[model samples]
Target: MGRILLIGGIGAGKTSIKQMLMNEQVSYQKTQMLDFSHVFIDCPGEYLEIPRFYHVLIDASHQVSEIWALQDATKERSFYPPKFSKVFRKPVIGIITKVDLPKANIKRASSFLNYAGIEEPFYTTSVMNKDGVAPLRMRLRELNELYND
Candidate 1:
């Protein structure tokens, strides 16, 4: 299987999503650096939050098969800038995280992703409840098949 790189703002649930997909115990923890696993590359949120660290993400993008640009559904602002995905040549998938939260706004999150240049069919997920996890997993599997074949 190919690896995926997760990028998003702080507390956007990137680590939680990685833990959920890897079937590891999901716990709240700050990512201090780049984390490499068998099927995922978990990036620190600061890489996306800081403009100078963008090169780190762009350089790291070469090692992964796909890039996931995540947006916290409850966050009012987006860490991603317009056409952010243009920096990566690989497929960039948009994901709306923490969708099960009471204050989550899927529409706004989707628009944020859209402005970032991530197209339609954005996935919504809530690691706490495992909502939308199955479909996202299936889609990842499909992408792996298509890329690795």
Candidate 2:
């Protein structure tokens, strides 16, 4: 929790989740750049979508403490490749965003994260409804404490 970076495809709720955790208003403004705060880094989804931008994240990895490889439970296509987590030395947490969506598929999200080699105990969250946000925040705090210790 030194500085958590949220990485995922667009419309996957990274900004919403960040706002939820920050207790800020949930507006629909799209993140057009690599926006980050003192505590959170909300990466643009296009970086992950475009092959050339992978290096950007890889380079940016040096600035963050951990990575949240998020997936939209409501979306269909799997975006991550197998063992993708190996590219990062930082701890990777698999997050299934938009869990409150009508079409959420938790299993499929988890499957893709697992295939990507993300660590166990993946989290499911819905920023709008505040579902599963508290526990994740608590866990981040715990991780922060551990990092400090």
Candidate 3:
């Protein structure tokens, strides 16, 4: 897969999903700054929450092949404005995290992602339980192929 960038609000499972994708030590650590890995680039959630910080994401987008706009199903909030993904030059996808949470709302999460301008079918993943990530991996592979072609 080509380098992928993970963007989302705080506690939206960006770091956890990165661990799952990288097979790294699965633990929670608040990303203080942009954490670059071989497979993914994880950015702080505050960047998405504050419009002033969006420039960080815009700049980082230039370095990656794809952008994942994530939202946690467990918590519903409008962090992204209409068609926010369009801000990035790279292809943008949506991911719904914490799908295994007790009160997770997948439908609402999909709506939020759609509102944020993710054109393809958004992924729903539960990093803790290791569920639904395979599809995402497959999708990433597909994206990589298209990007390379």
lDDT of 1 by residue, 56-99 (tens): 99998899888989999999999899999999989999999999
Give one digit per residue, the lDDT tens place, for model 2 in 28-138: 888898886977878889988887888888877777888988999988887777787889889899999888889999998888899989877999898867789888989
| lDDT of candidates 1 onward, in order | 0.92, 0.85, 0.86
Which residue runs of candidate 1 sit more than 4 Å off their true CA positions?
147-149
Q: List the residue pairs that clash in candidate 3.
A: none
User: In model 3, where is the ten-residue run with the lowest total lDDT?
Assistant: 140-149
Query: In order, what is each prediction's RMSD in angstroms?
Result: 1.3, 1.6, 2.0
Error of 2 at 138 (Å): 0.5
**Tens digits of lDDT, candidate 3, 18-99:** 8877778889899999998766889999999999999999998888888988999977576989999888888898888898
Candidate 3 ranges beyond 4 A from true positions? 142-149
Please give the TM-score that candidate 2 achieves against the real structure.
0.93
Q: Sort by TM-score, best first: what order? A: 1, 2, 3
Candidate maximizing lDDT: 1
